[model samples]
Target: MKEYSVTPNKNAEGWYVKIEDVAPTDLYSKKDDAIAEAEKLASNDTPSRLMILDENHEIVEEKKY
Candidate 1:
């Protein structure tokens, strides 16, 4: 089994999720969406880092060691 960290970030509109420290796609509009996608990727059991951003291209959320 694989395990990943999920965190919610607050921005101008609402909260956003940053999965593993990589850039997020348009499909991810909020925290929940990012986490859902991350969950799927985590199933692969591969290490990953994601950094979700907002409309302003700023980091809204992140997961670090």
Candidate 2:
């Protein structure tokens, strides 16, 4: 299964959508945007998981596709 995550940047300036074991390619200014993108990616990649983290890097929500 594949996995994707949406986390706040270290500085809290933006959000990052990251694939498991891969570096993020884009940073979204809004957390919602990041989550939306991650969800789309996860849905497209069936048998995937989407993890959403808060500013403190704690997993807040998890969804499986």
Candidate 3:
């Protein structure tokens, strides 16, 4: 049950879902899509945390699974 984060990618454009320290993957064209995917992944491991970040790289919301 690793913690996950959905953050915006400034360089490539789009959002990314990161699992722990490993390089973030699961790029999405929209922030909502990325958040949804992150939540789904977190759901598999109950009680995991999913952090959603804004374009400025600041955390805007946190979803608990």
Candidate 4:
């Protein structure tokens, strides 16, 4: 199954939505915005999962579509 992830940017000032095995979307300054976009993309692209990562890059939440 396809998977998407909401991960913190390197600077920790922004977030990005990444589709597994594909290029990630643009950076988002707000976590909500990033997750929102990821959900939309994941739902539209395929039956997938949305994984929200914490500051330490650990999976904090996972939603299956």
Which predicted model would earn the best lDDT?
Answer: 2
lDDT of every model, 2 decimals: 0.48, 0.91, 0.84, 0.89
Q: Using TM-score, give the best candidate's number.
A: 2
Worst 10 residues of 3 by lDDT: 6-15
Instruction: Give one digit per residue, the lDDT tens place, for model 4 in 1-65.
Output: 88999999888899989988367778899999999999998888767999999899999999998
Task: Flag the better candidate by TM-score, 1 or 4.
Answer: 4
- Which residue runs of candidate 1 sit more than 4 Å off their true CA positions? 1-31, 42-45
lDDT of 1 by residue, 1-65 (tens): 22344444444444443343443333445657666676566645555444455556665654432
**Which rank order by TM-score, best down to worst?**
2, 4, 3, 1
In terms of lDDT, the poorest run of 10 residues in model 2 is: 21-30
Model 1 / residue 63 / CA error / Å: 2.2
Which stretches of model 2 miss by more than 4 angstroms?
none
Q: What is the C-alpha RMSD of each candidate to the true structure, in Å?
A: 6.8, 0.8, 1.6, 1.3
Error of 2 at 47 (Å): 0.3
TM-score, candidate 1, is: 0.37
Model 3, span 17-48: residue lDDT tens: 99983698778998889888898889998879
TM, every model: 0.37, 0.94, 0.85, 0.90
In candidate 1 the C-alpha lDDT for residue 8 amounts to 43
Distance (Å) between predicted and true CA of 37, model 3? 0.6
Candidate 3: residue 24 Cα off by (Å):
1.2
